[model samples]
Target: MDLWVAGVDGCKAGWIAVFRNLKDPAATRLHVFAEFPDLLKFDPPAQVIAVDMPIGLPERVGAGGRAPEKSVRPLLGQRQSSVFSVPSRAAVYTEDYRDACEISLKTSEPPRKISKQAFYLFPKIREIDAVMHPDMESRVFEVHPELAFWRLNGEAEMSLPKKIKGRANAPGLNQRRDLLVSYGFDQAFLDQKPPRGAGRDDLLDAAANSLIAGRIQFGEAEPFPKSFTRDVRGLRIAIWA
Candidate 1:
């Protein structure tokens, strides 16, 4: 029996999902979902799903976002900038960016406001947050692509980045692509142009998440903070790789 697993990444169109058979890494399929719930309801359900999005919502944020984000940043080296400081739950729930920033400043210990990058992700973050709960840990896990790459690269951070000044960096992308190839993914499949509404980076990121999904399914991956925390909503606040 081929148990399926998926690695999902949020994109402008929606979510880019990469599904693969756990027993056969070469067997893969890519799909884009306009909504988060639809991804869960995908045909041939994935037994485990590792997504590159925040899963927990903390009521009061500490200095570097949550424990998971804080823990993973040190391991990412230069890529640490890719990890944004998540705001408090009240801030994340706000509709206006300014209001969200105000709430975050009031709720955080050091009075930090979320970045524009993080603000842009609020909708997708809320989208997934709305459907996730504590019990879903068995079937769904939070993953970070950089952290996954760190694990794949013998615990060393990648020297290049996926983007440089908002543009895709070919060398950096190839560096990641090479890692995926070495991880047993089919190059041809990975090389396929991303489906409409998604970017090349989105496809690669979803592919990276797939590896983490397999790791979580097999108990090969560990959460950033060995001791995980829970949000006010009981959702587990941890990043796995």
Candidate 2:
């Protein structure tokens, strides 16, 4: 079996992943896994897995949250808000939101409050951070769908929001689909509705990240922080596009 490349995004239910055999772009596949470990069960396994989630976290709060997030925020401009401040490892390990916030406040140098949004994603963040080993850095990487789309759109931030309420055919959705189509994604696949738990944007985001994964596998992608820092566990915290 040919090794495949995968892009993953966290969803309400679990994770939505887009997999493609680089040798045959037309053979793209979508899958939903209940846990991060489930994603590693593919037959040949994905040689390159680009996921849109915070991987490496700081032991204590720094001037800016994570180095990778800081570098990409400016590039995103209008969409910078999409990048949430990642809590420290201590905060992520906390069981409750209040506890998480308290841990963040104590761990941060200047002290910071952990957003509910960031706290909600703690489980997913912890999931990756737990399994990611130093040896897997070459194959598994961090990526942001918005940044990937920005690069796909010639380095310009997308003008339209990804999710539009009460409108099935949003322009932003079409724009993303069109961009992916240009990169050899099948229109049929882009048009496919996500399963019960996943949303349309989740699929689109995964697809975009998958393209980034392909680029990375082929040596065509760039990392946000030219010089990245690793956590105490030896996990590199950098976003690629």
Which pairs of residues clash in candidate 1, taking residues 3 or more apart in a chain or in different chains? none
Name the top lDDT candidate.
Answer: 1
lDDT tens per residue, model 1, 172-203 = 99899999999898888778989899988899
How many collisions per candidate?
0, 0
**Candidate 1 deviant stretches above 4 angstroms:** none
**What is the lDDT of every predicted structure here?**
0.91, 0.89
Q: Which stretches of candidate 2 lie over 4 Å from their true place?
A: 164-169
Distance (Å) between predicted and true CA of 217, model 2? Answer: 0.4
Q: What's the distance in Å from true for residue 137, model 2?
A: 0.8
TM-score of each: 0.98, 0.95
**Model 2 clash tally, residue pairs:** 0
Please give the range of 10 consecutive residues that has the lowest summed lDDT in model 2. 161-170
In model 1, the Cα lDDT at residue 187 comes to: 88
